[model samples]
Target: SVILFLNKVVISQVICKALLVPINPLFVCSRHIRNRYKRISASKMESATEPGESVAGKSTAMTAGQKKEDRMKRFRELHLKRNEARKLNHQEMVEEDKRLKLPSNWEAKKARMEWELQEGEKKNDCLARGEDYERVKLLEVSAEDAERWERKKKKKNPDPGFSGYAEAQLRQYHRLTKQIRPDMEEYEKQREACGEDFHPTTNSLIHGTHVPSKQGIDRMVEDVSEKQIEKRAKYSRRRAYNDDADIDYINERNAKFNKKAERFYGKYTAEIKQNLERGTAV
Candidate 1:
């Protein structure tokens, strides 16, 4: 019984020494980690059952995986809290225009009013200085200004309906005609002169389909000849070239080019040209 008791003491002491010794955990795979912890726990259990001296508790050091998980959990908590606050603030803010559902023309309205105010100020200054204020109108480019510009352009530059002639005189005619007033008296007098044959057709009187009149035939012939004469006079122009003028260029095109070059550099080279001509140039 004494020998058996000594053997048990020695065995317990050896197991206690092994358990108390610190484990240097090498950085390895999960399989090695699980096996290492299981072996230490199994030894602890065996020692617990037949222990003479009690070993101090095993100090479990954290694994790399557990440390990484804790770090990620903290990160999520911080970012999520900040992002949720921002979202709540965004939802709380309300714009007046959006809330009222009004068409946003703030930019265009502000620009137009500002322009009017500036013009008024300018006019006041001009009056104080005893100068006539010429109305200098220029529309500013803006968001809603497109529609206004379209209407103005349509009214001012109206499309003239097609006529037998080019009808070029209609352009700028509005500016001249603005001062001219309607003469209903003259219009009625002209209508009376035309009579019932107001809508005249060509060769109607000549073929006797309409009653022929010597006066109307003569009037028609006279009108046609006058128009022909007026057309010829309108296009004809007298162009005379001077024979006395110096011919310094090859052609009209070359003449234009030489004139341009001379206009740009003539002053700079004038003295040099004079020196060369006098045989004094080095």
Candidate 2:
């Protein structure tokens, strides 16, 4: 019984020793480091909260007058900042204007005008001496005038040489004597069969017919001449307004006309005048 008890005791001690033995040194070190970090974090938290509490207490203790003064100081600082920014912007704008501004071209224009005046005087002197103006005017001839001159020259001399002239004349003769097409000949015969008594509207029902109409050049010329004469008469009437006698005559005539109008529509005029006085007339 004593040996059995001793063996059991040895077995219990061995189990307890095995349990107490360190499995890993790193795990023991990590646990110790974590506990230290926790204590330090708690102390840091307390320190941080202390300053925040003091700021809260100070802000709560501030008076209304002190708050107003602080607000005014902030506003003044903002205004000064804005003024400085504006001055910087204005300075930049002025610098940009100076850099981009163009110099005037008036001197160049004056020089050109003086040169043109001298050329004009030279041309006038040449004209007075009966010299040919063609050479002097060559520089001033525009593309339009040159084209017009070429067209006029071509019209005056269509065929430049004898061979060209002969060919053109032959072509003209052939065009005049050209044989008519069968269709056109048939059309002409059908037209003749219709007779002068047949109305164009009735003939058009079968086949369309185009008749040449006169342009009436004389009538157009007469109309234009009449318009020009009327325009001159109108101008004369307008010019007469500048004369004292004509003005007096016109005023007298207008006065007489107004009197006639007043007699004819006296009642309507009186009503209009009354409405105008009352500010009711449009």
In terms of lDDT, model 2 sits at: 0.68
TM-score of 2: 0.17
Segments of candidate 1 deviating more than 4 angstroms: 1-92, 96-100, 135-282
Candidate 1 lDDT over residue span 227-264, tens digit each: 64687579655445669955769997786676666656
What are the clashing pairs of model 1?
Answer: none
| Best-fitting candidate, scored by TM-score | 1
Alpha-carbon deviation at 174 in model 2, angstroms: 99
Candidate 2: stretches off by over 4 Å? 1-22, 63-282
Which window of ten consecutive residues has the lowest lDDT sum in model 2?
237-246
Candidate 1 has its poorest 10 consecutive residues by lDDT at 52-61
